[model samples]
Target: MVFAASPLHADTSSTAGGAIEIKNLAKRYGSVRAVDDVSLVVRPGEFLALLGPSGSGKTSILMSIAGFELPDSGSISIDGRDVTYLPANQRNLGMVFQKYTLFPHLSVRDNVAFGLKMRGVAKAERLRLAEQALATVRLEGYGDRMPAQLSGGQQQRVALARAIVYRPKVLLMDEPLSALDKNLREEMQLEIKRLQSQLGITVVFVTHDQGEALTMADRVAILSQGRIQQLDEPKALYERPRTRFVAGFIGETNFMPVEVQSLLPGGALVQLPGGANPTEVRAEGLVGNIVARGDAVGALRPEQITLADPDDPAALRAVVNGVIYGGSTVLCVAQLTDGTELRARLPDPSRVNVMAGDCVGLRWPVEALRVYGADAGAEVAAS
Candidate 1:
C-alpha cells in the first residue's frame, strides 16, 4: 500500500504555495555565461520582479526556474521538494509572456478550458471552471469571442485567464506588458497587482522597466551580468544603496568628485577638487568615510539642491547655465564658481528667472550627500 500524504516528499510548493530557493544556479551558452551563479529566495505570496537592462540575465533566470533551460550546476527547490530535474509541464506554473499567445481559432471559453481538458477534467466541471476563470479576468459576457475579435488588452487577459484557470502553484511572467501602449500597460499593471494579491499566489515577474519594478514588486531583485546585485524593498534600495551601481541605476543623480580632507564623528569635511577656489564643504555619510587618503565622488540628487541669490549667506554662489521648463517643475542647470555643473529642481520657473552668466547660489541639506570610493564604476550583477 502506498501512502499519498508525506510531509517531506519530493514536492514543489511544499510550504503553503512553497518558498522558491535557488542555490548557486549557473547557465552558460558555449563561452558566454548568460546566468552566473545566481541564488535567491522568493517567499510565499510575495511579488518579486527580476529587474535589469537588456541581456541582463533576468529572462535566463526565469527560464531556469521554469525548467526551460537547465543550469550547469545548482539546486532549485520549491517548498522542500527538489525540482531541479522536473520538466516544465510538471511544475504546475501559470505563465504569461510578452506576446498574447491565445489561439486565434479558439473562443475565450474554449481557450481557458484547454488546460483543464488536457488534465482529464470532466466536461461539465471544465466548462464551469472556464466560465469562472473568464469572470475572474472580468470578461463574463465575452467568453464566446475569438482572439482576433478582442483588443490587445482583452486578448492578454484571455491569455491570463487560461494560465490561471487551472490554479497553478506559482505564476511566472516575462515582460507581459511590454507590448501594450503606455496607458493600457499602466492600467493592466494595477489590475494584475490586484489579482495577484487576491489569489495570494507567489509571483515572479521579469521586466527591464525601473518604474514598473518599483511600483509592482513587494521586493525587487536588481540583476546585471546574470547575478543579483541588490534584493530589497524599493524604498530601502532607493534610500540606502550599498553599491555605486545601485546609486546610479535606480534614479537620477549628479556625481561630483571630491577629495577627503578629514573625517568627523557625525560626518566628513571634504574639498571639491575641481570646484572654484577649492571650497571645503561638510557632508555626512559619504563614500570616503571608510577610506582614509584618496579621491572620491559624491552623488547629489537634482531635487536636493536649491537655487538662491549669490549674496545670500545661506546659498553657495553660482551662475545659471541653462533651464528646462517641465510644467510642474523646472530643471535649472547651473555652474558653480569652480565650474562644477549642478542641477536644481524648483516647483516654478519664476523663482529663479535668470539668463546665462548671471551669478546665483546653491544650497542643499547635509543629509543628501552620497559618498562613493574612487573605483565607483563597478558594474552590477544581474539575474
Candidate 2:
C-alpha cells in the first residue's frame, strides 16, 4: 500500500506525513554514471532541497524519487514500505515541474480538482477540496480563470494548488521558480515555505539556485558529479562546509595555500606559503577536534575578514588593488605579501573610504577558519 493514506478521504491537514529513505541508489546511462551510490534520510515533514549545478545529478535523483526514472540499483522506501520498483502512478506523490504543466483547456478549479477526479472522489466533494486548495494558495478568486488568463506567478500558484488538492503525502518541485523574475521568485519562495510549514508534508525541492535552497529547505544536499558533497542545515552548511566544493558553492570565500604547522584540540595552526601563486590554506573546526595532514585547504569567508590598522600585529599585510562598491557593502580586492589575491567584504560602502593603492592589514578570527578537503579539485597543491 502507499505509505500515507489517500488525501481524498483522509484528514490530511493533521497528517504528519512519512519519512523517505533512499539507500545505495545508483543510476547510469551507458558509460556515464548519472547518480552514483547516493543515500539520504529525509525526516517526516522535512523540507529538503537537492542543490547543484547543471548536469550535477540533482534532477536525476529527484526523478528517481518521483518514479519518473528508475534507479539501476539500491532501494527507496517510504515509512519502511519499499517503493523502489513501483510505477509513478502508484507512488501517490504530488509534483510541480519547472514549467506550469496545468491543463490549458481546464479552468483553475477544474485543474485543481483533476487529481481527485481521477481518484473517483465524488464530484461535489472534489470540487470542495479544490476550492480549499485554491484558498490555501491564496488563489480563491482565480479558480474560474483559465491558465493563460493568469500571470506566471498566478499559474504557478495554481500548479501548487493542484499538486496539493489531493492532499499528497510528499510534494516534489523541480525548479518551479526558474522562469519567474527575481522579485516574484523570492515572493513565491516565501509563499511556498509558508504553505509547506502549515501543511506539514514532506517536500523535496530541486534547484540550482543556492539562495532558493537556503531560503526554503530545512536541510540542503549539495550534489556534484553524481554524489552529495555535503548535507546540512542552511546555517550549518554555510558556516561549516565539509568540502571545498561546498564552501565554494554556498557563498563567497577565499582559499589560500598554507602548510599545517600543528593540529590543536579545536583548531589548526598553519603557515601561509608566501608565493605569487602558492596554493592552499589549512583550517579546522569541522566535526573533529583533531585533523591529520590531508588534502585540506584554508577557507575564510569574505565577510569574516576585516581591514586592520597597520600597527596590528595579528593582521596579514595586503595592498589594496581594487575596490568595487556595492549598494551597501564594498568588495575589496588586495594582493598579499606573497602576491596571492585576497577579497574582503567591507560593509557600509558609503562610509568606508577604501580605495585602490591603499596598503591595509587584513585579519580574521581563528575560529572562523575552515579546512575542507581538496579532493573536490583536480590538483592537490604539494604542501
Candidate 3:
C-alpha cells in the first residue's frame, strides 16, 4: 500500500527536537562491559542505526538513550539538554520494541491515546490526535479494532502510531521489525523511512541485520566488543571499511594470506600466496597497518573476482572445487595451489559452463583487494 505524506498536526514545531549527543557512555553488567567509552551524535531529523551482533553493545547504547538503562559513566543530551540522570517518562522520547507491546483489551484508538491521557491532555483533543496518528500510519479505518484481531504487521503499525502520537523529540526503535516475515520486514523498512521523512523525526534504530540497517538508515554505527568500530554511510561502510572487522561484518569477503613486499605512496605492494606477482593496493583499500616484509591478509569480495582461462599470464591459477547455482548468480569455489579457497560470483549461470575439478584462473582489479595486518586477521578470526 502506498501512503501519501500528511502532517500529524497543523503545527509541528515542537516535534523538531531531534538532536542527540552521547558522551563517553559506559555500562557494565557484572563482569561483562556492555558499553565502554562510546560517544555518538545523531543529527536533527536524521535516521541513524546502531548495528552489531549479539554482545556487541548496540542494544545497551539504545537502552541508555531511552533512559531504560543508566550508564556507569558519561552523559546523554537531547537538543542541548542533559538527560543522563533523567527518568524515562521525563525524557519525552518515543520508543517501539520488537514486540508490539499493545494493550490487548483496549481499542486501537485508546492504545494510541494512552500516552496523551497520562500527560493530562483533554479527552477530545487526545482522541483527535490519536486518530491523526492512526491515519499517519495508514490505519485510518482500523482504530476501533482490538489488538488481537490484527495481523502482525497491523499490530506493529499500531505500536508505531502510539509511539508517535505524543510527538516525541527522538524515536528509539529496538528491532521493531524483527518479528515480522522477510517480505513484511522489507515493506515496513520503506514505510518507516517515509514516515520519518514526512514528520522530520530523528530516529535511533538498533538492529543486527546488516541489510535492514543499510536499507533504512542514513548512517550506520557498527559496534564490536563494546566499541564503535566504524561509523559511515552504507556505501562507505561496504566499499571502504576502516577495519577488518567492519569489512567482514558488513558483507561477504574472502580473506587470504599475503606477504607485504614494500610500502608505496598511499598503500603497499603485497604478494599473494599463489599469485603470479606482487600487486599494488590503494590506501583506502588498506585496513590496518602494513609494514615492509610483514605478513598480512588480503580481503576480496566474491563479485570482484572474475573467472579467466588458466593460460592467462596475470591470472592466479586454481582448480574449481564446486559450482553452486543461486538463481540469478552462480558461485564458483576454487582452490589455489596453496590450498586457499576463493569464491567468484558470476551472473547468469546458464551462460557459464564449468565443472568441478576443472582448472580456472582468478583475476581481479588492483584496487579490489584490501590488505589487513596479521593481528587484524587474528582479531577477525576470534570474533
Candidate 4:
C-alpha cells in the first residue's frame, strides 16, 4: 500500500534526549573478542546503522546495547541512566528481530497488545495502542488476521508494530528486512525510514547489506573483525574513506599501483601506472610515510573512471577486455599498457563505446582519485 506523507504525533522527545553512550565496550566469547574496545555515541532519534560482514562484531555490539550480551568492560547508558547491568526486558527498548517471533495462535492485534499487557497497560488502552501501531505500519484493517494468514511483508510489519506499541526509547532492528522478498524489502526500507522520522525514534539498525545501509542510515559505522574502521554519514564515508577497508567495503573500486612524487595541501601528486606524469588528487589523512618516496596503489572508484575516445583529453588509456551489462549501467573492465587492470562504470549504456578487444583511452578526474599504501590491497576486500 502506498502511504502519502502525513504528520504523526509521536513523542519527538524520544530522540531529542541525550544519547546512547558505549564507552570501551568489549565482549568475549571464550577466546574470541567478539566486540573489542568499541566505543560510540548514538545520537538521540538518529538512525545509526552498524554495517559489516558476518563475524565482524556488528551483532555483538547490538546485543550489548540491548542488554543481551553483557560486556566484560565499558559502560552503556541511555540519556543519563546506567542500564549496563539492566536485564533486557527492563531496558525499555523496542526490537524487531530478524526472525518473526509472533505467537502462532494469536492474531496480529493480540500479538501487538502482548507487550502492553506484560507492562500492565489497561486492556482497553492496550487495544487502542495496538490499533494505532498497526495504522503506523499501514495494517489498520488486518489486526484480526493470524500470522499464518499474512504475507511475509505483512508479518514483518506486524513484528514492527508489536515492537513500537509501547513507544520505547530506542528501536533495535537486527536485519529485520532480510526475510522479505526484494521488492518488499525495498518497500519496507522506505516505510521504516519514514516511520522513524515521523516517530522521531532513535533507531539502531544492524545489517551487512551495503545497499540497505546506504539507502536507510543517517550515519553508518563500518565494523571489521571486532573493530570500527570508520563511521560517518553515508556520502562522506563513501567518498572520503579514511582507510583502505573503507574505500573497498562501501563499493567497487580499482586499485592501481603508483609512486607518490609529491604531496599537496588536500592531496598528493602521484606518478601514474606507466611512469606517466604526476596526477594530483586528494589523499586526505592517508599515511604520509607509506607514500613518502615509494610505490603505492591509487584507489579509483569504478564509476569515477570513464572510457573515452582514443584521442580524448582524459589521461589514462586502455583496451577493453570485457563488459558486464547491468540494466541501468555497465561494468567495463579494461587493461592499461602497463598490464594494470581498470574498471569503469558507464552511466548510460549508449555512452560506452569500446567493446571486447577494442582499444580505448580511460580518463578519471584528478579529484576522484585516492592514493593508499601498497598494503592497501590486504584491506581492499574488507572495505
Q: Best by lDDT, which number? A: 3
RMSD of each: 4.7, 4.2, 4.3, 5.0
Candidate 2 lDDT score relative to the true structure: 0.80
Q: Rank order by lDDT, top first?
A: 3, 4, 2, 1
Candidate 2 runs further than 4 Å off: 1-13, 273-296, 373-383
How do the residues 179-259 of candidate 3 rate in per-residue lDDT, one tens digit apiece?
999999999999999989988889999999999999999999999888888888999989887677887898889988899
Where does candidate 1 have its weakest 10-residue lDDT segment? Answer: 1-10
Per-candidate TM-score against the hidden true structure: 0.88, 0.90, 0.94, 0.91
Q: For model 3, how many clashes?
A: 0
Best model per TM-score:
3
State the RMSD for candidate 2: 4.2
Model 3 is weakest, by summed lDDT over 10 consecutive residues, at 1-10
Which candidate model has the greater TM-score, 1 or 3? 3
Structure candidate 2, residue pairs in collision = 256-280, 256-281, 257-279, 257-280, 257-281, 258-280, 258-281, 281-298
Q: How accurate locally, in lDDT, is each candidate? A: 0.76, 0.80, 0.86, 0.81
lDDT of candidate 4 over 1-383, digit per residue (tens): 00011122222133332379888888899999888888899998899999988999999998988887889999999888898888787676788899989998999999988867765667888889889889998999998989999999999899988887767768889999998889999999999999898888888999989999999999999998788888899999888887777788889988778888877777777877753467776656354355556888778889987766766544676778899999899999988889999888889987766689998878877678877776644332232
Error of 1 at 250 (Å): 1.0
- Model 1's alpha-carbon lDDT is 0.76
Clashing pairs in 3: none
Q: Model 2: per-residue lDDT, tens digit, 336-364?
A: 88888889998988767878998888887
lDDT score at residue 63, model 4, on the 0-100 scale: 90
